[model samples]
Target: MKTDVLIAGAGPVGLTMASELSRYGLSVRLVDKNTQRTDKSKAIVLWARTLELINRMSPNCADRFIETGLKTESVNILSGSEHIGHADMKEVDSKYKFVVMIPQSDTERLLEEHLATFNIKAERQTELTDFKETSDGVTYVLKHADGSEETAEASWLIGADGAHSIVRHKLNKEFHGSTLLSDWMLADIYLTGVQGTPAINIYWHADGILALFPLQGTRHRIIANVGESSGPIGEGNRPAPTVEDIQRVLDTRGPGGIKAEDSVWRSNFSINERKVDDYRSGRVFVAGDAAHVHSPAGGQGMNTGMQDAFNLTWKLALVSRGICQPEPLLSSYSAERSPVAKVLLEFTGRATEAALLRGGVKQSIRNHVASLVLGFAPVTHTMANLLSEISIGYSDSPLNAHTQHPRHGVKPGKRALIRENEPPVGFGDAPRFALFAESNNLPSALLLKYSALLEATPRAPLSPDSLSLVRPDGYVALATKSGDWNAVDAYLNQFLPKAS
Candidate 1:
């Protein structure tokens, strides 16, 4: 079997990359070792920026994903049944504030549905055993569940596989980070007799931190920082989570001493933060968990991964089609994403530490401070935006770099912030440059010169350019003041065709 691109591990990020490549009219095939979607809701929040990006890809896709999941408005902090503070994300620019309580399996299922529209479905029950990459492309010896072996080749391969990524290992890449000293457990349960459970709850008990996230329609998904959240359950350790062990937590944590139905699903995972030294090894590249991993406390894990897919696909598409030089563009993948991984890891680590403090005056002081700060509008909105995963921006890629031509052709660097447009749509295979003019058309002067690669849109008004160019993966490619075309050719030449 062969493909122009083969993505391994069809988690949200992998599936997204596959679908994105399809949108560019590229041949893409997605592969996963999992036999089917697992019924667990791991990552539940999509930030404002991500929603904006999705709107460009397919407006209703983001809305449908929202409609499919449980949505919450407030982030409540508690101390052993005592209310500390309630942070409402509704204030954030995005319409959603609390993490949407959707199961991970549902995310995969819905993403799969979106990909099917592009004629790409994740190939299941297949494993890549012997895969090699060279300067030109990648080749793999895959094993089928039926005990047959086949050879596959691709112009490029994306390893969206999770932490223990074979693609990362095959590249002889190193993962540098520490496994957390503690583990945790998350479970989804339906409330039977209990009435009116809160939308979202966090209990900072003397024992540990426990969070109850309300599923859009289901009762709740409980995430507990039970001193490593998972281990042998005994000696007041919740007894290691058998059906009986899990039932005990549900019963004990019940509202008003109320007992709830058993968990519909359960998962135990450890905490760790790590990054791949290199994202690209010749024609094979790593994205999402393949590139970085971190504790899920901030819910940034899934967001970070999906953004990686978003960043890489457009670059690959441009280079493969002879639009830009592959080496420089590929190198930007690590340069742009490494810093983001670092920031997310640090913030999530801080949130986790603050949530799981041992009892003491110092701990009390810290908890008091956390609650106080959380009560502030700015603090909660900041954390909420980070969790939504839309606040991030990328540095100098060919498509997004500050050009010598004119106006605001270059943006605010990786931290640049732009307001979202009401009706968002891309200029056909463009994730890099969005053109905005009052006339709602390309700069007539440069249109013929860069017409083959650039698309100018006149939607609403995005500032001067009033339009934004999104990379194929959906980050702003470049922003320009209205009618600035001095460096247009220079910029386009970096990633697309230019006048001979």
Candidate 2:
């Protein structure tokens, strides 16, 4: 294979997958038909959990893109005349809370900048013309804008292209879901709000789902799902939104309002909820909108796509390095991400439904009751964190089933900090299957029974008592307490080669 991985589309998800795979010392090639990434931002936020995972994947990650230009303090949802509830991202105790509002363009630019350090660049204006997949890998015909065609082979091909993805079509993955027949409008503009006040995402029911996301300092974004009776924008995607639309929504929002002004960019969109029948297809897999495209109510599209890369990157790297059997590690990728995507789809869809309610007393009662109850419920306080992102854990993984042996400072199922004395929230995303054999600290324990798993699989970078086994794509394969050889050997031999 000329390249270990070929990523189709240089959007956030594809770019991230490339960066992550490159981290494993793999040769990654990325292609995009877009001549250039635009300055206009589309998706406008990064959740805390995603940011944390990105930082873990690339330590210098957070500092690179996280500017004062990007930070939303919190989220407030208005229900009719009353303030229903708010999501305090600060409560998550993350340096970045809720979602950091940066335009999609800037995000792509930042990711591209990072990829540059790795000596990788997006082959722009290059389209995948023909693709052939064999049991071993995939080969694709790349047609340059100038009409020259070149063939490239890679052990794996990832499709991160958007909804109209050609890769998913070729794979014949079923996207079994419904699209909202009603139309919606989206706009990005400068609002009069100060830098730190809580950004409001109001649900007035009858008015349709209206969301206002903070970006950088004073700029903001608005997305409104239009009522069916309102009629569709004759040119879907080309609504030509005017100050009239902005003024109308603001006027509808009852008094004590902060005005949004000086609209910069505008467009209309139709919301849809959909997911692929499966994310993997032989040596070709799908991520981001290609795999699962849902309504962007929770702002989870980009976050989910990037997280998919995080899950797949380490696994692909480890398998390529002969650290573990390719199947086991790769299988875990879909297992982990699919569930997360399902939950996100459900949450965002429900939020959208509630936001786009038609005028009625029943709607009023439902909105008022929810707002009242949620205001006092502690569970409501966690809504922002849940919506922002989730910290995926492998403790529930069937492959990671094992009993724990207690250590003084060490704990089971936690990503143990390698050298730090401090207690860890979570750590360790190394691309190798790590087994922590603290028993006797002997070479025999590591080399004999656990040899195949230990040969290329390094010891847990975090500690001695912990056995941190990583999958090829860099997620914790199995992190169990170090103990006897019998069970550990059986567990590993199931997936790795036996000692010579």
Candidate 3:
């Protein structure tokens, strides 16, 4: 069967991509080699930015996620008995200001249920064995469980298939970077001595870093750096850590008095920071671990991948519908997202390195400096916003356009925060730019001419006599004064043909 988009790997990223395309009234078939969704709570914690983006897709979407997840407002860091630093999510400048602690399992389940609203289900045990990208479309070879192969054609192909992506391999793209030297351990268990508030508690010990992430009532996820590795830990090669193994780390690094029991999931892992140079090649693209993987320092791995889906799917939808030209719209995907990935990699790498520091002098200095710096409210607020990903934007994107007389508040490539009861820019079945200007000052001819590419009516302006054109993904594309209708026309005209 032919489809508009064929998604490989029904993980969170692929599911998100398919859900978005389907939401935009596009045909999508999601396929996975695995027969069923993961039962383990692998990647946990959806930050504020993710929830905000999901809410833009549908009013009830983010609400559903909030219902199933536990909310934590602050992350406290301690060194030995001394309080080092803390990140207070309450300081984040967003409506959903806290981190939502939900397992990757529940995330996928809820996403699948959401996809069911579109009458779509992921085909199980079906894998993309091979494919070729032609000028017209992508031809994919699907291998079934019983070894039967069927060929299908699709207008586009997305590989969310994971780190060992066949699509990336077929494209001959290099996954550059290195594996971190330290071995890590992750445990999901029920704890007894978690006191006071259920905040994320992290202890930076001289030995290693031990982090406790609250999942549910009395249930927490424990992750720690366990020193140098003999070699890379392979899947299922290393046995699960026993209760005593976790207790030892807790007794040595924890803030004292926490007892562990009722172990749910435990495994040993090594951190690897690898990413491809580009996200798109011809009609094929990759997201999630397939495109980038990094140290789980700030829990940004899955969130970043999912945002990649959010970023690309909107542009792809617009281009596929012939509303926007392919050159800048499609090309901007890599230009915009690749830099974000690079920044994330550097941040996570430094975090992991600091956490794994073995030298006593360096560790002491780090702890002392951290305490002094993070004690400031502004520093903590910045950390909170960065961790929540509310501060990320395509500041250098090719799509960003600015006028000489730019407005003061909203700049190009920055997020345009929408208020309550108002529809967000790019919210609906089709992707369209929202023009924010005074109703009288809005150029009626421009709106009439580019009705297919713009909002039906101008929304209330942020500043009087100022005009802002926001993209589908909520980033400001053009910011200029009200009289600069010519600039706005030029910005929109790039996405259309010269003859038009």
Per-residue accuracy of model 1 over 1-500 as CA lDDT, tens digit each: 55789888889998888987887768987888888866667776665666555555665567777787766676777775566777666766554444566677787888889889887788888887778876667888777889799887988888888888999998889898877667676676665543453456666766667777777554577777556534443223343355555455545543455444666776666777888777887788888888888877766788778778767777777777676667567888878888889888888888788877777776689778877777787777776666666467665443464644335533534333343544443425544444444554445767665554555443444454443444444455556665445544555666554467
Error of 3 at 412 (Å): 0.7
User: Considering TM-score, where higher is better, how would the candidates rank from best to worst?
Assistant: 3, 1, 2
Q: How well does each candidate superpose onto the true structure, as a TM-score?
A: 0.87, 0.86, 0.97
Total colliding residue pairs, candidate 3: 0
Writing each residue's lDDT as its tens digit, candidate 3 over 1-500 gives: 66989999999999999989998888999999998999999888899989988887776589889999999999888887898899999998888889999999999999999889899999999999999999879999999999999999999999999989999999999999988777788999999987777788888998899999999888899999776766545433356678899999999999889999989999988888999999999999999999999898889998999999999998889888877778788989889888988999999898888777788999999988889999998999999989998889998999998578765448888878867778767778888898888777666899898988898988888777788889988889988887678888999998984454
lDDT of 3 at 271: 85
What does candidate 2's lDDT look like per residue over 1-500, in tens digits? 47889999999999889888887678889999989976788777788767776665565467666773466666777755567777777676454555677788988998898789789999899998668897778989888999999987888899988787889888888876777766777778787743346465665646666677767666778777655624543337446678777767755652335576888887877776888867887788899999887887778898899988887887687677676677676786787777778878888888777766676886787777777776874666567558666434554444563645434223333333333332122233345344545545445654665543453434534454565554433344444555544545555666663466
CA lDDT scores, all candidates in order: 0.68, 0.70, 0.88
Sorted on lDDT, best first, the list reads 3, 2, 1
True-structure RMSD, every candidate? 3.8, 4.1, 1.4
RMSD of 2: 4.1
- Count of backbone clashes, every candidate in sequence: 22, 15, 0
